[model samples]
Target: MGKTLSGKVVVVTGGSRGLGREMVLAFAAAGADVVIASRKIEACAALAAEVRDQTGQRALAAQCNVGDWAQCGALVEAAYEEFGRVDVLVNNAGMSLLYPSLDQVSEAMFDKVIATNLKGTFRLSALIGARMAAAGGGSIINISSVEAVQPEPMAVPYAAAKAAVESLTVGLARTYGPAVRVNTIRCGPFDTDIAKSWPPQVREFMAGHTVLGRIGDPGDIVGAALFLASEASAFCTGSTLAIDGGFQ
Candidate 1:
């Protein structure tokens, strides 16, 4: 992966941990200068340091609350200031809360889930999409979830937001056209903080859904991100690469 993204600049939201963190390392390994953003300033800074140490590539840590429009703007601006250009944007910050069924869902929980997962992705996509368009071209990778398609009983709101993400991926691809590529990866169960937070029973159930009979690692997504970011996927847009281990 040497220099596949050499001299490129990338921004990965929620990059302080989990899949977002892995994507930060992946991009840096491919020779891209990366901006890692999350609400946790210390976490971001620590990840930035680790990335720079491991990959020897420039990495910046920015505190960003993706639910806030002004904060998202600042996140984009921070990326530009750090590297002067953004060649790729990965909208990966999101949240979820599981319950028995839709009846168990609360209005406040629904709103918060939608705000972070849907509104955040939408806001960041608009900001980065414009910059990519103005710069003549770039890639936008949205991280969706298998729940978007599988639609488990416990994750109604999460599934809805993720489904919306898939739609946004396609819509943006259509509108941006040959200028900027927009794509998505409908990620399956992964061994991350999100999964660990799930109740033990749900975790066991998810593990059985995959043919692999195991949860996924955060690094499982690196290849898809690399392909979309590199020229290898130049012709790919409006596509949803399901990294689900045949869960569906």
Candidate 2:
């Protein structure tokens, strides 16, 4: 996949750590100049430096809280200002809070979950997808979660937001189609930073639940992400690709 994205500019939100960070590095390695955005500018800048030094790809570091519409707009502006064009956008920023119980999920927590996981994806895709369509063509990938389909009581708010994201993917694909392709990546239990917080029994259950008999590694997502970002997935859109280790 090296050089598959040469001369292309890619933007990834939540690009500082975990799966987002992995994609940033992989895309840079594939010869795409990348914009690394996250709430923490320091972390984004650090990753940008690594991309530049290690892969010789130009990288832009921008601080953005995708949950806020204004910040999402600013992120779009900054990316275009730096790269002039965005060939690929990965809506990877998401959050799910720990609540004591369903009845105890506060209003703030619910709103925050929706804002970060759903609203942000919508705003980013709408803004950047329009630009991409006008420019001829590009790709938009929304990172969703398996909880959207298999909801757990503990994270109902997050699951609901993700479900909305899946629906948003279809609407966006239609809105920007014939030029800009939009799709979703419905992820399962992956051994990301968040997984570190999972209790031992929860981890064990997750592993046993997947047909692969294990949670996914960060690198496991690279192939699918690269495929969708490149021409390999030219015919795919408005679809959800499960990288869930055959979770059943």
Candidate 3:
């Protein structure tokens, strides 16, 4: 983590909190200038200030709703305007809304899930990846979920979107290979703010079901994220790295 990403400019969507926030801080601490993008500008600005003060790295706080195509474009423009170039793009923004049942799921609900989890990733990756490739080389990291492979009844829309994201990762790698590296981190349940909504029994079940006998911490994602963002994963692309503590 010592200047591993020195002089690099990284943009992380949904970077104001949770796993995204962890990656933003890690990237900044590792010597990368970061652009923190999220719907919450206040949170983004607060984190950006923390990064600058603590890590001594340049940080730009941007308001971006990745679900919207126009906002995605503005985010890319903002990052480039602030940093001149982007060396890493992490498509980390995502959402999963609960519906009463499959039949009760409204079109808006389904669309929103797809837009945030899948469409945004595609748009951002396409925009930034092209620049990365043209600039010689760079890395694009897509944050996926275990739901992509193991679909649950309650989160079908989210699972479908994430599955598309996995496929999108491979397609993007092929599209921007030999220069721009594209990969996915398929994650399992983590003890983040989201877990606060879970009942004690649910949490217990989640912990017990994982091979590690515990849910992942927010920082658990930092290692894989750093590897993918830095030269440690130079030969990796179009790969899915599972950081799920062996969830089965």
In terms of lDDT, the best-performing candidate is: 3
User: Tens-digit lDDT track for model 3 on 155-209?
Assistant: 9999999999999999999999999999999999998888989999999988887
Give the per-residue lDDT digits (tens) of candidate 2, residues 92-123: 99999998999998899999999999999999
lDDT of 3: 0.95
Kindly state the number of residue pairs that clash in model 1.
0
How far in Å is the alpha carbon of 107 misplaced in model 3? 0.2
Q: For model 1, state the Cα shift of residue 168 in Å.
A: 0.4
Residues 100-151 of candidate 1 have per-residue lDDT tens digits of: 7688788988988998888888888888898889889999999999989888
TM-score of 2: 0.99
TM-score, one value per model: 0.95, 0.99, 0.99
lDDT minimum window of 10 residues, candidate 1? 96-105
Better of 1 and 2 by lDDT: 2
TM-score of 3: 0.99
The C-alpha lDDT values of all candidates are 0.90, 0.95, 0.95
Better of 1 and 3 by lDDT: 3
